[model samples]
Target chain A: MAKQIVKALDGAAAVAEAMRQIDPDVVAAYPITPQTAIVQTFSQFVADGLVGTEFIPVESEHAAMSACVGAAAAGGRVMTATAANGLALMWEVVYIAASMRLPIVMSVVNRALSAPLNIHCDHSDSMGARDSGWIQIFSENPQEAYDNTIQAIRIAEHPDVLLPVMSMQDGFITGHGVERVEVLEDQAVKDFIGEYTPKYSLLDIDNPKTFGAWAFYDYYFEFKRQQTEALSKVPKVVEEVGQEYGKLTGRYYGLFDPFEMDDAEIAIVVLSSAAGTARTVVRKLRKEGVKIGLLKPRLYRPFPGKEIVELLKDVKVVGVMDRSIAFGSIEGCGPLYLDICASFFTYGNGKAPKVVDYIFGLGGRDILPEQIEGMVRELIHIAETGEVKQVVGYLGLR
Target chain B: MGELIEIRWHGRGGQGVVTAGEILAEAAMEEGKYFQAFPDYGPERMGAPIRAYTRISDSPIEIHSQITSPDIVIVVDPTLIGLVNVAEGIKEGGVILLNTPASPQEMRQKLGLAGKGVKVFTIDASEIAMKHLGRNIPNTPMLGALIKATNLVSLESVIRLTEERLGAKLREEAVKANIAALKEAYEKVQEG
Candidate 1:
């Protein structure tokens, strides 16, 4: 396969290219900065007659989701992309898209959800929608952004899992990073993932199914139970699809890739774009005889716990860095990982790794390798003599 | 991993520096290599001066975001030196692809370089764009100099991207003149 070289592309174009390969029935999106160019390119695709897809220039991000939900409900494989404030605007109906279980896939170019109004990349937007009944996946690079968009469609529209999925990439990281990405082949993708066969849809007028039924107290719990069961099965489906994708493309997609953990006493868990920075530190430390590993959570909603516990089995220290603030919480993703580690210790009757929470790169701050290396050094010091640094620390604040 | 060429462009808003960066990206994407093109909007915008960056590599890019460290810096405007600190973060082997009519020696002196090992390729790209394109859009012509200076991606590939990415109506003549301007810019480039 010949590689296509691009000098630079804004974040929007990178996403728009992936959408073109998916070739959905309709794409409805509202314009929002950092995200506007993606739809603008789609609109241009519509105008140039380059793609045989209908593009709806909607009034708002909320409308974009509504239109896609309606389109997917009518048996159309639909997708949309939006960023920070736009995702917040679509908050109300986002729950509806998931609860009614429209297999809609969206790209959340992550940005901070505002009180002071920021447009830069932050996990706040997607993190706020954590419990929205959607299978959320975070991508580390443009290649993942491209591959994940297509897979997101396949996963969301799966027969057993007719749920909405929001595929996320950092606003500028994967979005703006101009790197060579092998846009997957359409036939290979189609053969590997099959066509979108939505099990049940409102579009079938012959049968006529009522979606979003007003469940009374007697039946609501069971309906909710079934949805939870359905959501639980997503990780398996994701693994299956990822395996098939790996066979076609040489790059294997793991829910979490443990780098240099084979001989590690400390493991750092990062999400989205910062994983690359962590890996750099991981590589440098390993070469210098430091046993440091990296855990990047691909599927945040499904939270790959058992795999994490198994990977961290021998390690003594675990550092979790979260890019968003869950105010009044333990800070960053540390609390969540802390809970996971605490559970492991409780259940396994084994010592849990000394866990530390880190809050870094919020509102587009830099995640440098030195900072990562410095933390690992601190962890090593703690490992040598059971002393601890501040458990919940924010990186790069002076 | 093949030829990790990073080119940095420095210019103020409305100077078409960012456009030049995009042109380089367009050209490379035409050649079918994994390429990234973006600009740094650092608490900055029109008239405030900013940077547009590019990284061209054969392998899939794992790193994203700003080109904090660059292999080449394209200075579209010279007065930027007196105002903005243009030479902030350049890698060890990196070069400056500037749009100046000065000889390489004169440029080195103007840039306060006498001892440091730096390759400065100077071209009057703004003049070429005006002469050929009948507009002050130095992006195309300057890109020609960029191709000649760094030899990153071919000038032909750039012309192809311009055709593919440009509107259909503007595709034919714009591609032709841009190629010609690119040739002029590439020819005028003096490496030192």
Candidate 2:
């Protein structure tokens, strides 16, 4: 195994370091809260000549994605970084980039959307883009952010799954918080990602091709179906790439990471940094002789429905904690909650646990261990009584 | 550091509170310990009150939340004592390190920390920084006091890591002066 060099870095800096190592052909980004450090640090690398990447300081997030699409379609390895409003601004291009099958890797520092103009951590930004056809992966800390960013390149460029990837970390929490991260050697990363050899490139004059070509009735549906088919392959590709990265770095990743779930009667399903807190709570509860556990999803887009159902089917009660709200939905739960419910409803063979939703940490509200403990206690109650008083609940709300 | 040691840093923007946390985290990393450092990022304007946090442990830190009940609180800006509740949610027997010209006893009285079971330490870190660096950036000096109060990491390691982190960006003279400030504050910090 290759030796790992551990350094203290924030999620943004870690992602920037990965980008420096990958040295993608193009990085077009606009500065935004929480995510600004990623481009700022990467641009410093460009100025210092550490990486030979063409850094484009675009005016808007939409323009940034547009530039990325143009570069990626030209057979270049392209990347970008953005947060809440920026991701919202790139709404049109975000879907287009995926539909065009451009392998653009984007770092989405997760932040809350604005009507109140708050710049704090939440899953709303990325969850809003969940149906936009991008492969979404969430990171718990700087280490995962670094590892995911590096692995995302290979996953995006995989021939069987040529799709854009959004590697997400919590805004401010992970983006600004510095932690110990083990970085692989540049040569190892370069070799792992190899090269981006576009099968159909606009730059390849010998084989003429048109990207984002207009398709009416018959072809548009087929193209959409093809995009859906491509998405179906992402889970396998993600796992394969994750295994390869684990072999090199010893930090393995799966669709979802289960902690202390072997004998857990009650579990909490969550994502990103909250999962870290949930794990800590699980340890505490386990010591207290409670069969509590946590399930943290690293891969969000492909949802990993069957795998998640399989994991939770044996549990008595499961609580789904979401950092973003799915407003106006029938259940009035968060996006992740809706997905988990949908998964159980579809694939559960009458062994599905009674799942409840807890919306927590929206707009960067702090979710303390005590709050998690309370949620677990509630889950235990649900398991004991075989009744859920409230299916959708809010945590840490006054 | 078998258990997690959470530290809350209170300072103003541009005072290097965030950088102090980063340098301390780097020193802890050098000691082969797991650590996390982060600022409560807000609309950053110079002189606006800011807060940063650090968590050092022998094992990996799994929780990612604001340090509500800190084991140690380091106040880099003396004026912030009245503006913000610097002692809010401090764990019982927690240590409070302040950069003030006042004596530890006087500071304890002024901050109303008497009989709180909280240990208070004081250092004229701003004066030390001004004497060494000719500026009021008390972050490095406060870091020195933090090491003296908590002994979370060695002073030598912190100075070395400071140089490593700031060497490329700062002038050689500034780096030397900052190191000197750290050493001076380490020796000068007084316990109440």
Task: Give the poorly placed runs of model 2, Cα more than 4 Å off.
Answer: none
User: Candidate 1, residues A1-398: lDDT per residue as tens digits?
Assistant: 32333334455566788777677788888988667767888878779886778888889988988888788788888888898999999998899888888888888888877777777787888888888888999988777787788778778878888888999888866676565566565566556556777667777888898877888998988877877888988988888888777777766776766788887888888887888778877877788888788888888776667777888878888888878777766543433555466657765456677877787777777777777777787888888887875877778776
Interface DockQ of each model: 0.40, 0.87
Candidate 1 off by > 4 Å:
A1-11, A48-54, A331-350, B1-3, B23-34, B42-48, B58-60, B159-174
lDDT of 2: 0.92
Structural RMSD, model 1: 3.2
lDDT for position A362 in model 1: 78
* Residue pairs in clash, model 2: none
Query: Residue A68 error for model 2, in Å?
Result: 1.4
For candidate 1, what is the TM-score? 0.90
Candidate 2 lDDT by residue in tens digits, A295-375: 999999988999998888899999999998889986688988888888988899756889999999989999999998988
Scored by TM-score, the top model is: 2
- Evaluate model 1 with DockQ and give the value: 0.40
